[model samples]
Target: MTQSVLDKAFRDVVIANRILANEGVVDAYGHVSVRHPLDPTRYLLSRSRAPELVERGDVIEFDLEGKPIGGDTRPPYLERFIHGAIYEARPEVQAVVHAHAEAVLPFTVSTTPLRPVVHMASFIGARIPVWDIRDSFGDTNLLVVNMAQGRDLARGLGAERVVLMRGHGFAAAARSLPEAIRMSVYLPLNARVLTEAMRLGEVKALSRGEIEAHASMKPDDPAMWRAWEYWAVRAGCGDLLTARP
Candidate 1:
């Protein structure tokens, strides 16, 4: 049972890496990570390869401090601190995705808050918090390059499941890989829809109660599997025949 769990986590991490790219949730610059099944204090992430190219072997183990433990020779992402600190902060979250989505960028810079403009995004509730790196550490490269910066960002993130970095990108956290990938994908789609609707007229966003109901509910597993399957196939996942999980 333990081996099965570990194997599934590893494979799902690979699937999520590819799914995010195939779904346009991430391109060359973004990244994803999944909590280690054998040890909660560690995680699985790829060396500095592009998302689409992250094969199973490219995945490396990192401790809670985000230090590579498996002697992985490839360069690790500097922003890995982003994933590390969030995992430390949120024990319930097993998956994390970070992306610089074009559609989400406007809301991060403007006073216009990104809301639950669609059903798939109702889990985002009434507002997605924006973490202004400038307010904490002014006038430098925007990357959360170190553990201290990562902790500060996590503090800003607080209880929210998603956070938008001012002048940078956004992070999505979930209890499962599919849900994390789903949020990463929908954030941009929701942003695009909201942007267009804003041009047409004032948009009526989902109500707090509506968002609350969805939050209280169990995830629709079949729907999630379908999404994962579609993305897995589209991304040319190595073993699509039995990849669902």
Candidate 2:
């Protein structure tokens, strides 16, 4: 890849992982993915490492089938199946993020859904249905090594950008790495806020109509993009941010 494109992808991945680590959404467990340049059937991901430690050169290219391509020297990530399953199921998604954020994991262990506790969380809406892996398939485990199980996990996401893996973390997809990062950040924040509010015992949340109204709006607002750019610069991610994707 040219320096220009490589820089953009590299920075997006690094900064995103760093921010996720800072927010306590991801530690050594989560991974992120970006669509491949030469073939949409392929994507780029890093070998297993803490989101906090993801470096620019750690990114590696792999086919959507979860096979490494090119002459890249690094080993592929163990969670590579999640990225492959997501891309296979949703062509519209350009990036994917899987993280074990604090707030989201609670819903996984119980019947509770990652409901739209707030309007801003309407991106997921009532569609944040937990995948009943046991019911879907007699087998209930879906860790990284479970490739077929990962595909079953993607089935719960539908067309939405986020899925809260029951007893697991979150798997989100977006049109770009920044958007994926934004969703990853926002989902956990929104979940935490809602969880806190509900715990207060008396809190008001948006109705389905209201949530739908907000969600129908385009997510790629210029103001938010500008905010991301500003923060990226402040975080010293500008050199990579300025590069063309």
Candidate 3:
């Protein structure tokens, strides 16, 4: 890719990390990554740093096998495999956010399904599939620590934009950084609202048709950009707009 295009891509990936942290989608433990601008087989992710602290210098390139490219290695996220496997499985997904958002966890461990209750968050696709680590690993720590576990999680995610990891957290996918950040931020909001609504009994989530309406919209559409701009500014990361390769 040209220098400008590549810089823009990496800048957005770094901004996404901060934006998600500022929006409470990710804090110390979560991470965000983007597909390589020039090479589909590679991606850009931050070193093992807190999402809020990620900067341009912290970004590193990794191949499909989750190995750092260019021999410039800092420690990668242990779950870097998650990003790699998902990118391998879903070509259209350009960004991924893995966060341990608390609101979404209740539903993953319960019978209640996390459904979208409002229009903006109705982009929440699928019935919110829950991936149980034990199903394959069989009684181990609940981390997608290896490529095999990451691929299994991807299998459960299927075409959904979000997948809840039972007793762990959720992964949000999108065609771009902003959309994935939006999904990461909104999944917990949807869950919080749904949980409160359930207290009144029989909550009414958006219908499948309502959710489907946004399926055709581009991930970088105006709505997504508008929200991203607001969040980026609020997070004090507006410098991303002026960043160059």
Candidate 4:
């Protein structure tokens, strides 16, 4: 990629961090990353910093193995393996988000699965798989810090766009940064809506046909841009809207 194209990717990653923070999909704990436009073998993620405060300078390039390139000494997120392993396993994924939104936590632990109940979250499909750390590693702190744990989690994700990590958060993958951000923001909203609908009566999630239709929406669609612009302004990164990929 040219210098301009590479700068745009970093800009989008910074904006994604802030947008997810503003939208409550992520806060101080979560991280987001995008595959390098010039080299798929490398990806960009911010150094250890709160999502809301991430900036272009904080963005670091990492190999698919999750090791920071260029010998950058800044600390990295412990669970960055989540991004690397997924990118390694799924060649189609261009962006990855790992968030611990409270609304999504209940479904991670409970038998009730998180599904797409609203049109915006249709990318999640009818059901989301849950990856329990205990199932593979036997009792330990629930973090995808190593390649082994990350690969197992990726296996659980399989062909799904989203997967809940038991006792933790959910990891979302997408073909673009905007789509990944859209899924991250709407996943919790869908969960919250599903919770309320369940309290009233039997919850009717989107039918298979409905999901298939809505999931066809692409990241570059006008509607997606509208959502991204609205979120960028809300996150105080409106100026960066021009830098979109």
Best by TM-score: 4
lDDT per model vs. reference? 0.85, 0.73, 0.87, 0.91
Candidate 3 lDDT, tens digit per residue, 1-245?
39988888878887898898888877799899999989999999999999999999999999988999999858889999889989999999899889999988898899777889977788878578999999999997898899999999999899888889999999888888888888888889888888889999988789888888977888768777888888889889887864221
| Number of colliding residue pairs in each model | 0, 1, 0, 0
Q: Report residue 78 deviation for candidate 1 (angstroms).
A: 1.0
When 1 and 2 are scored with TM-score, the better candidate is 1
- How well is each residue in 132-188 modelled by candidate 1, as lDDT tens digits? 988878996999898888888888888888999998999888877877888888889
Q: Candidate 4, residues 43-115: lDDT per residue as tens digits? A: 9999999999999899999998889999999999999999999999999999999999999999999998788
Return the number of clashes found in candidate 2. 1
lDDT value for candidate 2?
0.73
| Candidate 1 deviant stretches above 4 angstroms | 238-245
Best by lDDT: 4
Off by over 4 Å in 2: 1-3, 71-73, 136-141, 216-220, 230-236, 243-245
Candidate 2 lDDT over residue span 222-245, tens digit each: 644765576566655566565322
* Model 1 TM: 0.94
**Candidate order (TM-score):** 4, 3, 1, 2
| Model 4 misplacement above 4 A | 243-245
